[model samples]
Every structure is written in structure tokens, then in C-alpha cells.
Target: MPQPAPAVQRSGGPIAPHLRRLLEFVEPGREDVCLDVARGRGPMPAALAPQVRHVTAVDAMPEPPARADTSGRMSTIEFGTGPVRITGDGGPDGDRPAAATTREDRVRHPIGPDRPTIKADATALPYRDNAFSLVTARFSLYTLGDPDDVLRELLRVCRPDGRVIIADLVRGNLAGPERDRIERLRDPDHPGTPSIARLTEMITSAGGSIRRLDVFTVERPIEPWLAGACDDAAADRIREALLDEVDGGPKTGAKPRVIGGELWFTQTWAHVAAEPIP
Candidate 1:
């Protein structure tokens, strides 16, 4: 089985600050329907809800509930599947059990009082053509098995002239066998981290015209980075590899550095704002 994400760090909302800043490129407006693909609870939807008509946050995987309330002035819908029980005290979920969701299926999308969220795959979305005014995905492009196919789907669902914004760990140093080996160890699903140039070509080929590109780096601890890695061996292997890379004259692209005696890695991410042909 694939390993779970590293759990050694503090849990936070999914729409990271860097991602929120990327919003400037698209500059959402009122009367716009925004779809945040593969986006799990974060300030993104809540932030955009006021500016746009509605924001749909979709991700295939189920995530732990966010600690902070995402309830905006707009209506909300909390969606997922699991055992849902009502306490004797009347709560938001209800004073009654919902019979619509079968025991076998169990997967139920509960409607609530905030902006709606749904489960969906990036490549095969349930949305119709030209259904959204804006689409945003962060740190998802390079990890997919087939990024082009998913990118095309994102473009297809986007309205003509609508913007599709994506941010990912895109750097030239992330290429080559060494980087691939380390990434696969960290997350096997990670096919390859694409460079900015390569990502640009893919977006253009998928019928999108690039309008803006932003580059930034995030620093994080390697210990927490490997907490839920493929295995202890894989994690150890990656740590050793990173250490060796740092020891060597060429650090490659991983950008290993020591902070307060703890080892950290700098990841380069790129945000691209593009629009499909009208």
C-alpha cells in the first residue's frame, strides 16, 4: 500500500499562504464561479467566497476536518463518507439519521451552512464543459501519473476565457535520476517534478495561454518530511542522499540547509495562470 502523508508537522488548512498569494494572478471577481481542484479545506475558498459567487473545493481523498470554521456568509455543504451519528442534543448534523445514504455505500455528502465541497478526480471531473469561471490547484501538477490528461480536464471544464491557475514544485534542479529517486521514496505517486519550461509547454499544448508565472521556495524540515515516507528504509535513504548532496560541492536542486542544527530542504514551486481558448 502507498504510504500516508508525513504526519510529523502541525496540521493546518490546505490553502497555504503562498497559494493564496497566487490568487493575485487570477484576481477573482464577483459573479464568478470558482472551482478549486484537489483543494482541501484552507483559506482559499473562504477568501474567494466573498469575491466570487461561489467556490467549490474538490479533492478525491477524504481529509481530517479543519480546526477553524470555514463558514462564510454564503451557504455551506460539508461532504464525505463515514459513520455519522447524532447526539441526543440537537446539533448541526441533525436530530435524526439520514436514510438516503445506504449502510453499504455509507459514503454521504452532508449539506451544511458554508461554501460547498465535493469529492472528485482531477482527470475525470463531474463538472460540465465551461462550467466554471476560475479553477485553482496548488502543488498537484508534478505529482500526477499523467499530468497532461488532468490539465486538459481542468481546461475543458473551465469556461472559455476563464482562468486556470496551478502551482507546483517546478524547478530545473528537480530533474534527473537523483531527484527522481528521492521523490519516489518520499511519495511513490510522485511521477516527476516538472520544470517551469516543461510545465509551460504542457499548458500551452492543453489549449491554454500562459498569462502569469510566479516562482517561490518553501523551507521545511526533512524529519517531518519523512515521518510518513514510504518506509523507514526509504526515509533513511533519502536523508542520506540529501546529506551527501549537501556535503558534495553541487547541492543539485533539493537545496539542503541546516537550521538550528536541524536539516531542512527548500522546495521550489511555480504558480502559472493561464486561460483556455475562447
Candidate 2:
């Protein structure tokens, strides 16, 4: 059997810059308490600890074993020394069996113990109302039960002037060819991605006002990179299919080709500042 992918860390890649951007919006210098919802491996909390008075990292996934790979992309991404408080008990679910899961199951991002985490759902956070000055969710809303409900919960725990930051892939974020592959691989019952308009509605309904809206375009020619990671058989098939796409002629109702090139993914964010309804 092939080795599994290592747990993802906050250290780098397309997501790191955008995550930093959102954190800056919170103005760690001004926020008394920074709460990171679904703070996997505590990377973001670790980043915020020095500036914010306190960072409370919460997530449904349990803390992984000590060996879990939590290293960031680079050595220079400062893993701040401030205290991080986590608040969860359960661990993340293990990969499902082949019969039970798809190719996506093999792509796991393990977590580490840099900060506190909890085994609590986002829609029903354990914190009290108005508990934190800033709440953030990154690349996590897609898996939640009801994103609208989760947004409300974020608002519920936020101080009157606190902010709720949501970041995720917008609809049509992936390249056309890759999107088709993702649609096929994703669970049918998975919550559909929320578009920009849909996200605005969710926040407004949750009693928040949008402050900043930004869309990030992530273009990476990563198929070749990933092809190397797959098993020999899978890699051979992928290579052949890619060649077919490049040689485009006629399809005999077969698996279409996947041209390795600038594949696109979206990162849409909504920063909503919560205010008490007077």
C-alpha cells in the first residue's frame, strides 16, 4: 500500500497568504480575544498569539499523535511563542476503506498539537455569546452541516464589534477539467459550495455587516506534481489520459483527458463585522 499524505500545516502555499490577509483584517493588536474555529493543527492561532491577548483554537477534529506532521511550509514562518488554548476531545476520523471512500480519501491533511482543539461542531460552539473579538473559519465551511447555521454561531460568539471571517472555494473555483474530476470524487451529500452572493446572505441573516470582500485566484499546474504521488497504475492512466487531452481528437465515450496546466481554484472570503442589533 502507498503511504498516506501528511497532515497539512499552516506554513505555506496558496492558502497561507490568504489566511494571513484575513488575520491582518482582525488587527491582532486591537482584538482582545481571537477565536479560530476549525483551527486545524493550530497554525493560524500560533500565528496570532503574539499580537492578540489570547487565542482560543477550537475544532471538531481531535489532536493527532505527537508524530503528526504539523510543520509549516517554510522554516521562516514564525511559529509564535504565545500561549494557545484548545478545547476539544475527539480526534479526526481515519481514512475510510477503499470500498467506502474515493480517491479523495487518500488525500488527508493530518493535524498537530500546537494549539488547543475541541471535538465540537461549528454550528454549536461551546463558547458563550460575545466571547471573542474575532472568529475565523478557513477552508472548512464546505464540510459543515449547514453553513448558515455555522455563520450564526460565529456571530453568536463574537463581541458586538467582533468580526466573522469565512474563507472557502467559491462555486466554479476549480478549472473545468479538474472541476469535473472533483465533482465525481466528492461525496454526493457533501454540502454544495456557497457562492459570493450566498455567503453575503448567510452573514446578513446572521446579524452581521460585511466589511470586506475579496476573491483570490489560485492557479497551479499541479497535475504533474500529483501524478508522481499516485501509485504506478494510477500514474500510468493519468499520463495516458493527459496525453489524450493534449492530442485532442475524438472521444469514444471514455474517461476524458486531464491536461496538466494552469488549473484554477477559488478562495472567496467574507469579513463580516458583527454589531448588536440596537
Candidate 3:
């Protein structure tokens, strides 16, 4: 039987340069009311919670060990972490199963009530227009079914002067064909990463004025990476691609290496902040 993919816990781990770039771009203020869309474990909530007046974290699904009730709403439980709301998004019935972070580059789960995490869809946000001072999506934008609509929603909930922040993987690390193959093997839901140009175009087209753009790399270990695969075949192909590029190196773009006696690869991410145009 194909082994279940592994969950790469990144929040409680070491910080990567790309994540650092995001922190710099976010620059949450003391009086700012921020909204973090697709709140995973809670990286944005954890970091921005301290920076802003409040951080409303929202995601479609809850995390592991916590299942949704029949009514189809988030159920938060009292625990060691204050309120542990297990979040994930499988489907409407809420049984699809959340995709484990193949590359747990971003931070892990959100921490406290000051950074309240809620389960909701991005396209149909429940906030009024110009509701938040800042809206952000880290590493989760491109994975959505309707990335453009989500972008619009992000802009919608944001105040006219508010900023919409996006820090995500640019589809350039691996060769086009190879990356597609590996991703299909890894997670069927993996909507290939978008290029930096395409992302900017989307933002600007939505009437957002680009404010800040930063690009950086994040290195990921292969052993834990494979755990995100849906099947053994995908795991094998991805491993082989990295191994094939290990000695001579990858001509496509993805650079694979061995560190601490494990195979690894580097991913390029972009941090873009845009404000609603006047």
C-alpha cells in the first residue's frame, strides 16, 4: 500500500530567508487590523499577531486531530495552545483530507486568541468592504482552485489604503516539464506554481498598485518532502529527479543538493505587497 504523505511541520522550526522577507514586507503595525487568508497551522497569525491590533486568521479546513462537526463550521477546543483548532480543507463535506505541506517552508500553526483562527472559504469571505488594514496570503495563494477570485476577495476585504501581501513559490525552480511531472506525482491538487510575472500581472490587473516585491530561496530536505506524496510512484520519481541532478546538477532550474546526509532542493519564492489603487 502507498504510504500516507508526511506532514512537514515548519512553524516551530528554523526560519528561512523567504519567510524572513515576508516578515519584513508584512510590517504589521500596532493599530492595524490584519486578515490572514488560508491560515494553515498559524505562521502569519503567530508572527503578525504581535505586530498588529488583531490578526483574524481564516482557512477552509482545520488542522489534524480535529474534525468538523455535521453543521459544517469550525469547532475550537480548549487545549495547551489556548485554543487548538485543527484545520484542513478536503471538500464541501469536509472529508477530502488536507494536503500535507510538501515543502513546509512557511511557519507552522497560529498561536493565541489575539490571533484568532477561523475556518472559511477565501472566495466568499464574510467581511465587509474595506474591512481590514492589511490582508495577506503566504505560500497558499497559488494552490487554490480559483486563485484570481481569491485575489479579488483579498482585495475586497482590504481597505482602499490597505495592503495585500503575497509571499509564494515562483514556478521557476524546477524545469517546466520536470516540475510538472514531479508535482503530479507528489500531489494531484498541486496547481503548478505561478511565475513572478504572472503573479504581478494578476495583482495589478485587480487594481492593486504594486508596492514591494522581493524574491528569495528556501532549502528543503528530501526525506520529509517525500511524505507529501500521494503514492509511492510519485515519491520515487521526485527522488530520482533530485538524485539525477545531485552530481552534475539540474539544468532546468531546481538545484538539488545533499545536506546532513539527506537529499534536498531549493525553491524560489516571491514577496509582493500591493495597495488598493486610488
Candidate 4:
């Protein structure tokens, strides 16, 4: 199984501030319908709702789907927190049990008011074509297969003149050795991290007119990452897999030439905004 994301580290402080500043270009008012592709836990939807008529949160796997409130409107949707209770029989009153019957599938209760979440994939959206005025994928395109194809799909569903925005990690600024390490670890599905130039090419090739492109990085401490990785064994596997690269090429406790100081790795990201062909 793939490893879970590293936990949030308070030591590095909040990384969103830099991201929020870059998001200023996406005006909520100009949008009527918004779609968040790979909307992991719904934070983007909550951030976007006030600016658009409505927002749809879609993900490949939504552990516990977020439900709408009594009025069918939620201030936020706390998604990916954990599994949902199968309200029916397996456990009580003769209800039909859910497919996920194990304890690993369950988690603590939701904590905030949020929007609804739809379990779906990015490349194949369930909604009809021309359904949204804006589409945003924050730092998610790295793992997608054929990101250009994903952008094409986003454009396929976007209204003419509607916008498609993608934010992801960029590798342009890294040192030669660091860049080499990243390239080596990247798989086809992962595509490694992309540079701003590469990002622009992908969007342009997908037939969207580029509106704006931005580059940014998040500063984070290494401690929380170590802890979060501990949650899943796969994370340990990744650490073991990369030891040779990280430890200066094969069992050398000495640091790699790329990483010079206390800061382990610099998280790089990019954002691109484009519009459908009119």
C-alpha cells in the first residue's frame, strides 16, 4: 500500500500562507460553478465556496463521503478524516453492512461544518461537459498519469472561456545533485516534480490559453514528516528505498551534496491558470 502523507509540522510553521497569496488570482465572484479535482479533504472547496455559485468536491477515493447539511449547504466538508459509519445492519438493528468491514476503515468523528464530497476520479469526471466556470487542482497533478490528458479533460468539461488552474511542485530551482535525486526517484505515474516551463507546456499542449502562471515553495520542518511517515509502513519502505540517494550515494552517513544544511528538503510548487478555447 502507498504511504500516507507526512503529518503537519508546527515547527516549519504554516505552509498555506504562501499558497494563499498565490491563489489571490482566482476570483470567486467571476465563477459560477467550481470543481476541485482530487479534492483530498475539501479544504480547497471550503476556501472556494464563498467565491462561486457552487463547488463540487471530487476525489478518486473519499473514505467517508461528506454529506450536505439540513439546508444542503455546508460551510466546509472535512473529507479524508476517516471512514463513515455504515448506518445500517452489520452492527446494529439488522442493517446492511458496508464493504469496508475492518477497523482500519474507521476513524474519529467530523469536527467542522463543510461542503459535500463526491467520490470520483479527475480524468473521468461524472458531471456533464461544460459544467463548471473554473477548475482547480492544487499541488495534485504530480501523481496523475498524463497530466496533459488530465488538463484536456478539465478543458473538455469547462465552459468556453472558463478557466482551469493547476498548482504543483516545481523542480527548477533545485541544485544539480538534488534535481538528479528527484528525477531518479520519480516514476512515470509520479512524473517526478515539474518545472514551471514544463507546466506551461503541458497546459498549452492541452489546448488551453494560459492566463497566469506562478511559482512558489513551502517551507516545512523535517520532524513532523518523520512522524507522519511512521504511521504507515510503506513510508518506511520509501525511506529505505531512498537511503542510498539521501545518504550521499550508498551507505554514506554523510549528507548528499544537494542537501547542505539542517533543512532536509525544500518543497517546491507551481500554479497555472488557463481558459478553454472559445
Per TM-score, the best of the predicted structures is: 3
Cα lDDT tens digits, model 2, 85-152, are 11111111111111111112211122334322444667787778888776777666655546777788
Q: What is the RMSD of candidate 2?
A: 13.3
* Ranking of candidates on TM-score, top first: 3, 1, 4, 2
In candidate 3, stretches whose alpha carbon ends up further than 4 angstroms from where it belongs are: 1-18, 61-116, 172-175, 249-252
User: Candidates 2 and 4: which is better by lDDT?
Assistant: 4
Whole-model lDDT per candidate: 0.61, 0.49, 0.63, 0.52
lDDT of 3 by residue, 165-208 (tens): 88776764333666555656778877776776788899888778
Q: lDDT per residue, candidate 4, 149-254, as tens digits?
A: 6788888888886778776666564323444343333321244556567777888888887776555444443333434332445444435544555655553221
Model 2, global lDDT: 0.49
Question: Candidate 1, 42: how far from true, in Å?
Answer: 6.2
TM-score per candidate, in order? 0.69, 0.58, 0.72, 0.60
Angstrom error at residue 226, model 2: 5.1
- Candidate 1 vs. truth: CA RMSD? 13.6
Score residue 14 of candidate 1 by CA lDDT.
39
lDDT of 4: 0.52
Using TM-score as the yardstick, the better of models 1 and 2 is: 1
Better of 1 and 3 by lDDT: 3
Model 1 lDDT vs. the true structure?
0.61
